[model samples]
Target: MRAPEREYDSDPASHAHSQTRTLSSSPPPKTNGYVANGHGSPINGSSKHLKSPVARVELPGSTIYDDSYIDREEYIRLVIQSLRDIGYIESAATLEAESGYVMETSRVAEFRRCILDGTWSEAEGALGHLGVGEDDGLWEAKFLISQQKYLEYLEMGKITMALHVLRNELAPLHMDPELLHPLSSLIMCTDSADLRQKAGWDGAHGSSRRRLLVNLQSYIPSSLMIPPRRFVTLLDQARLHQISHCIYHNAPVTPQHFSLYADHTCDTDLFPRITTTILQVHTDEVWSLEWSHNGKFLASASKDKSVIVWSVGPNSNPDIYVHLHLQDHQFPVGCLAWSLDDTILLSSCEQLIKMWNTESGALIRTIEAHTEPVSALAWVPDGSGFISASQDRKINLWGSDGKQRDSWGITATRIIDLAVTPDYTRLVAIGESAKDPILPPPRSDATAASGANRNGNNNTATSSPRTLEYLMIVYDLTTKQPELSVSLGGQLTSVKISSDSQYALVNHAPDEIHLWDLFTGRLARKYTGQRQGRHIIRSCFGGVDGNFVVSGSEDGNVYVWHRDRAILLDVLTGHGSGSVNSVAWNPRNTQMFASCSDDCTIRLWEPSAGDRDGDSSTRLAHRTADDRSHEGEPNVKGKGRSRESWVEDDSASRSL
Candidate 1:
């Protein structure tokens, strides 16, 4: 797979050293006999100060930076801990002394020492002084200490002492009975070796005591006991924030690739703009698309009543091919859903939903529950069942065998699309209260025949004022009941929930995608830039952490926006004159994405050659050769474009 663009000075080791340059050269800023108030803002004359003696020397009157969020003493202590963690023992001690900010309180330090020495009673006694109140926190700490004490007694073959600790000490703590049952069984051990093996303990003399200390620290506040590797944790959080905010961050982050010398930002070229391959198995406009959970296969439903599952290559070659061509549906396929295991697929053709074995392309079963056209399909997270929404105003739950399990509910309007959250907590659907005036409504067989016989008097040919009342209904999947309903105004196309289940992106006509916060049940933001006043244009959540939103536009361009900021980042153009219908990003491969269009093709995309690794020349040459090899072949079912069209790079016109 292709990697993102990186700076020339990419030596992480050099960057690591550079990050510490300021730290190694400067001592903590000396306090001027002043300290921060309760709010951490500096006050005159030491109104408040840290418990550490080092705090008197090094902690500034204010935060580390003038506008810094962290308190001054806390920052110093974190630095001191960081210094100790990186083998700067003397430096850590010096900073602790100069800063007057002890990494831990004397009582907390003694608590750590007692735990490490296996002096269980002293450790247990020190818990109160370490600032853990007499509550569940205190009880939990005592339980941990007593548990360790009992385990050590067992390890030393002191069965009677172990029994006494377990019954009198651990039992009296009123802890979970489940926790004590296992310890009670340790009494039957033949010897210390048996006890250690069965308990999965390395013994009290090993790292057990130290591990206990770490566990006990959770009950103590940071002010009393510094969290281990506090400095490293802070840096990691900062780096993660940067990566999440970087609009073009597509590559996996690693120690070798991540650097603290500068904030992380990837080049726009890494956002999968360049079209690398064209899939032409479908004979008509590709209407729907979905990537299997594993990203190994991409399934596209087309207007020709066919579904094509394209097998994606492994990372090294990064190629794609036709894996299965299912032509069983007699009507145009509208939507698709892949089972969590990627072994089963559900494709909807009008009112009938067909389940197929993805591997063999055999129709498993056909579901005939929906009376109207099935608008969308979503599989339950466990893959044991699936959900089908229809214009019949009902959502039905079905088992893997295609038997209807239950109906969510009948809404008052037509359901356009629906999605179950990743956590399986809620089901969100886009419903329109009335037929949209701008778009033609679906007609039944009888209605179509009557309209055909009515000559020019058919009401279907008339246009009216737009009066679509778009709304989203959120259902509690567990109870199969509506939890929240949000009324929106638009010609709704589709809806996709974020991986976190916190936000839903609802595609709307007249060129907009409204992002709704599920928790607040409100519209959070609107993303626009692509033309989607008409036609069904589908958008998706993609990129790292699903931080980017991508959509197809009637203007024949793929629009990308940062999900959080509602900022348009890139407009990718490569499809022919037809409107881009839908887009899907490879869930497992962040560097690759696919866009299907009314042009009767699906285009695979990746980072530009300049920003990526591999033999691009050879890859492109192979693709050109592949396209040429299909020349002169019959264009099946009016697929429109010839195979030779794939070799021509029209990106120059499509790209900005």
Candidate 2:
């Protein structure tokens, strides 16, 4: 069998950095205290993770509620009636768990209302957590311990901590209506199997499985940011020729929403398609996408707990989404990484991480890996252990068995992103911290901020400090500890490291990209002026060729950039909304790029030899021979030529 290709390119130390300088003749950017923002600012602040501990509610013992203390059986009658009013019965059974799944004051009220309105069944694992009525003689007061732990995190802001909360310390216990309050353990169930399973046996998903606790739409308020208008405007101008580049040249949009160009000509197209076949995730915003080795399949984890594994082929259509429903994680699937031999997919959410069989999608193992939300996941290039960054302000390395091989955390705020080295020797993580106005620190000055730049959607708006500075973290996986830390001097959003793992690309508040060196922890190269394209949305570089990068913006245009020269390659205009979400390269071919956006389509692009612009080499030659020809004129970048088309899911709307 053929060995698999690593996600990382060959090491940068081994390769020559001077190679980038060669392909692009333009001068590298001048260093400045301020990172440039492309367009304007937005209102949403970067989410901060804060862990909140579970507040223990003291309950009275049996003696405190005795009839001798009460007036009569009347008090008992009243207590039973109140429970019934909240959908709790005089008999055993009926509790539902959610973000506020506990049988509490407000939750009970909500449960009562939901039951009356017929909206109660939608509650996750309600029937199991509520327990069943078996003969009404004996009751099992079991509780989905993980769900309660999640609630504790929600209350404590563990999700806010950016670290995942682990469920290992506490044993896996199924939900039972009787198991309402902690420290009040009761053998409430008469079921032989439920008791037997609880007494003896290892806890795993398939047999005695319980649902994972997850908090979707969970939010915390922070400061928003903006980019600059000049850059956005410049990118807007470059967008006009983008569709032409994609159609004829088949260039992918860099994160800057530009086509990869050296001087004025398009670079060798990279990131092409192995097949045109597409797979539908159970939901939108497929937060994570990874291709398994052998290139025969793709594993995608969604905000929907379901992980869909799709068979790869151009015209081959089999199971589009193999819905692997693991009762392990109840939260939206945030990050996924497969083991080297392609056995397990380590998926993380709020406080827990699980290992699943790639082929079956079943939860084979579970690990309560972090104290907060697991923000980022990275597989070691060597396929040994993997690294994860969490809101808990830490980075952790773990083995496939869910064991913590090593762990590290910063006193700094939340760790939002993580990147691992090729040999799995180093890891890079990025996160934001509050800018304490009084304490002066490392960055040159406040003017160093790139937050003023927006994506053209915002006219002119400045946001508040609920948003503060973000940090770029570097971890030495070999040392098993943090290597270096740098402040972006602004709130960071997304971070991308080069394939060579030498340079780190950062996207901050507003619209700006920082190309920083991994060794010195200093900004080396910076590119400004790519924003929401004419019709596209998001754009950035680090394409397949390891030369130039591409980006698709909300403006509905794709831009290719080589050093300072920003060029519009080709534009495919069919997205009704004039907005895009993400653009990516074909891992196999550098030439073909793909992008998906709010427009509900995935468009592919490549340069064509015969670009219908009528300014062909032959046309130019013919024009040069005639005195009346326009040979001396600069080839106008665009003449309305396009070869772009979209591959869409016909069943998307219908399936909905």
Candidate 3:
């Protein structure tokens, strides 16, 4: 890598002469190395150099689609979708006409015309397409255009080119939507009904490639070029629609297209192994545990009410969630939180959310926000604010002040858990359903048929729509109304947002956990192996669609469930005589995961040798030092382990 130019920083006077690389000089990558003649193998055993990777501006407040670049309407749609993709809608005040609402109607109309006609050239020529004219706003243009380009790749026939722009062009457009990766991954995709008989993929190619070809809708610019290449674009049944939606991203690298076969060549397959250890580590009875926004600190709220903050170690344990008011909750703290900025620690007793300064351990503010017990709290990613769900049957939005901004009533019998998308657009709640299941009469024919004879043997499994079933509700923060609801029939316990906000997982009561597609509002996959009656604590995802889910169950076991074919990849044991209560992942690390249980223990796991069964093409791994700890190893017993995560404090100690 070339060193940064010292002159650029040291000599302010010479800044004018510094050669600037336009934003990201991220050229479309060739799966095969660049050759002297632009052919294969370089022919000669000579040296070649790729440019040092540049950072993508998609930074905070930079620009999405600036006036300097592309068409207006395309940019506008992208803005809407991007807004939705990022989770901003749920937590943000509606994009006021004030505060730089960049999309003008003229721009919206003209761009729509271009997309309909398949005219990137004409669109490029439009008066307001780029910012050179009177309406120039590069940042706004970037945001808007990138969003449109996303949809276009699928809508138009430019999937290959569209993805090139996203990976090679758009993502860095701004640090990338803080929450897009997660939302993108969470989109609903149904299994592909067709499979190539000859290739087992139905066409002789593969399921992944087929998915890329059909699921999404986007507008492709005729002018933008697809660098010649070939690579894999793997998609299974569960993600057929997802691949289609983001189809633009699946284009091959040309000639030797980048592989996406999910066979020894892809890097997203670690979830199975990682999930196993997480499950094993939570086998004991767990009381509770919490995750840092970056997924570092693992805090467990015990039945004992005392909270233990476990340093994910290695990384500095930023004093997170320390708050003064937290100490005042008279009841055992039922829930705790580390704010998005790593700013405040929030604790819930019955009806209050006490904000405390993690560093000073002083009470900051208290909101009499709920009428009943408060169960979950989430901070908006943009750092705009936060929302909390409570047993009071309400979700409240609170600004820095303890005052409530807005509140929405919930029907979940009680609000048990919550997850806010990174963009803050949607708040997902797992609670009772207005449409719960119906109960059968006491004596049923099914019970008699089950081979158990009773006086009138009746066992009813299917009931009414309003039963106390597990349901996921996508509540629009702006509208404050339930937009969509999905019923998953589990006694919903807890919910979590992936670091990227791609997929949200919920622990269903009685041994089944359901994974939901956040966007389309559908059940994407199902995870098995939860012990009946054990709490299915919570879950976290490493990558956007990184095949694994780590769930802590009440059976005192944390089971790692792999998606697509929802399998119990591994089982982790040890912790409390009770079930595992909570789990978290280091946002910066994919290989490392943490879990805490009622057993009063926190456990961490790493990949064995960090060498798993797959390809190594992309470089997203966070650097980690040696993290081998036999910490929870003895407890990974997976069954009847006496390990406990709860430790009772002496009354004398409490008084002191």
Clashes of each: 8, 124, 140
User: Candidate 3: TM-score?
Assistant: 0.50
lDDT tens readout by residue for model 2, 418-466: 6675545566777656555332222212222111111211112223334
- What is the Å distance of residue 606 in model 2 from its true position? 6.1
| Residue 283 displacement in candidate 3 (angstroms) | 18
TM-score-based ranking: 1, 3, 2
Model 3 ranges with Cα > 4 A deviation: 1-286, 294-296, 315-328, 409-413, 433-470, 499-502, 534-536, 543-546, 608-656
Tens digit of lDDT per residue, candidate 3, span 1-656? 01122211221222222234233334211111112211112111101122233332222322345545543323333343344234443211122111112112223234344533435445545524323342443444444444444544533445567566567645665544763463233222222232122213332122322232111111222111111111111123324544333312222233353334532133333332332232222222334556666655555554444454444433221111121222354555666767767757777655667777655556788777565556678776666567788644678777755567777855544567788887777788876543424433332343232211100111123353233445678778688778887776556777876545657787776677777777666778878886645343666654334556777766777677655567666787655566666666666555656776665456555443234322111111221222212223233343211123222222111210
The lDDT, on a scale of 0 to 1, for candidate 3 is 0.47
Q: How accurate is candidate 2 locally (lDDT)?
A: 0.42
The per-residue C-alpha lDDT of model 3 at residue 495 equals: 80
Error of 2 at 653 (Å): 19
TM-score winner = 1
Judging by TM-score, tell me the better candidate of 2 and 3: 3
Clashes of 2: 124
**Each candidate's lDDT (Cα)?**
0.71, 0.42, 0.47
Candidates ranked by lDDT, best first? 1, 3, 2
In the range 1-656, model 1's lDDT, one tens digit per residue, is 00001211221112211211112222332222111111111222111132333222323345678777877666776776666566554565555445444454444555666777677888888777666897639988898889888988888778889889988999998988898898888888889889889989898778787677678778987765676777777888998899778767776788666888888888776667767667765777888899999989899988887888877754212344566778888788888999989889999887889998987788889888877678889999888899999877889998888888888667756788899998999999887775553444546774442222211112353355545577788989888778998777667788999999999999987778999999898889999899876577789999867988999998899998988888888888768888898999999888888899988888877765555565544543444333344344333233222232332223211111
